[model samples]
Target: MEKEATRKKYNISVEATLEVIGGKWKCVILCHLTHGRKRTSDLKRLMPSITQKMLTQQLRELEEDGVVNRIVYNQVPPRVEYELSEYGLSLESILNALCNWGETHIIKKYGDKYAVLEDSILNQ
Candidate 1:
């Protein structure tokens, strides 16, 4: 007979959501993906502060969580790209809300949203 897997419980509902998307880099990575598909190099360029090892680890974790899809293409050099899975697209509104709140906070403190934020494609 096959055994059934156990279901984990969370103290707060948000905690369960955080468990999958929580982290310093996960949201940033997902934000980039929301724009379009990106390879490891593209992501590194977008997020210059993240180390190669850390980026790999975070991507792997996201892939494992079923939020990110890894697409490997067979070519001369072998190319790989990452994109948000269907389920992951559901977080778009949440991410947008966080971004709006952050802009508000920055403007409130610095008197300008762009003052503290870097000029990137996502800034638009």
Candidate 2:
């Protein structure tokens, strides 16, 4: 018989959710993946502020959490890409909600989201 994984206890339900997605870069990375599949270089180009090492670590962690799919292709060198898993798709609404709230907050504080938000894939 196969062993079932143990369930983790969380103080609040959101804590469980946060355990997987909470962090400086995970949400941002996941947000990027929401747009489409991206290679490591593509992700780096998309988020220039993140260091390559940190980006790699974040990708590994996301993959371990079963929210991101990493694909490797056999080629001259190697090719890799990442996209959200089916399970990860469940977070789309939440990501959109967070984005909408951020827009509102930026506008409230800065008088215009256009002035505060960066021009990125998400904006385009």
Candidate 3:
């Protein structure tokens, strides 16, 4: 049955985790959220490379997966913020490891050339 097949598809712990957080941007979004609550605009500003549509879609998926909490406040123009749910916060260590691995990989692969560029961008 379709349901049975679906269940089997994510039976593995890694598969289950990936089902929720695997994507070009989901991990990155989660990493940023680990810092603190951020509005959609703030996320966009931090990651200018992502399109609004893609960002909205990824956030919606994260919310649906119960990994990200979306809070809305009544105000003149309406205010909304996103933060990691307790479940999402559980990913902190994993995200940190991934970030570390990425930095190491970049340094090893590109050496000082790309590291300086990345440093300048982060500094800016």
- Which lDDT value does model 3 have at 34? 90
TM-score of each: 0.90, 0.90, 0.85
Error of 2 at 76 (Å): 1.7
| lDDT of residue 101 for candidate 2 | 92
Better of 2 and 3 by TM-score: 2
> Relative to the unseen true structure, what is the Cα RMSD of model 1?
2.2
lDDT of 1 by residue, 26-58 (tens): 999998899989999999988989999999999
Give Cα-based local distance difference scores for all models. 0.89, 0.89, 0.87
Alpha-carbon shift of residue 99 in model 1 (angstroms) = 0.7
**What lDDT is obtained when candidate 3 is compared to the true structure?**
0.87
Residue lDDT tens for model 2, 16-122:
88989998888889888889999999899888999999999999988998999999999978999999999999999999898889888988899987776677854
lDDT of 1 at 85: 95
TM-score of candidate 3 relative to the true fold:
0.85
Candidate 3 wrong stretches, greater than 4 Å: 1-8, 113-124
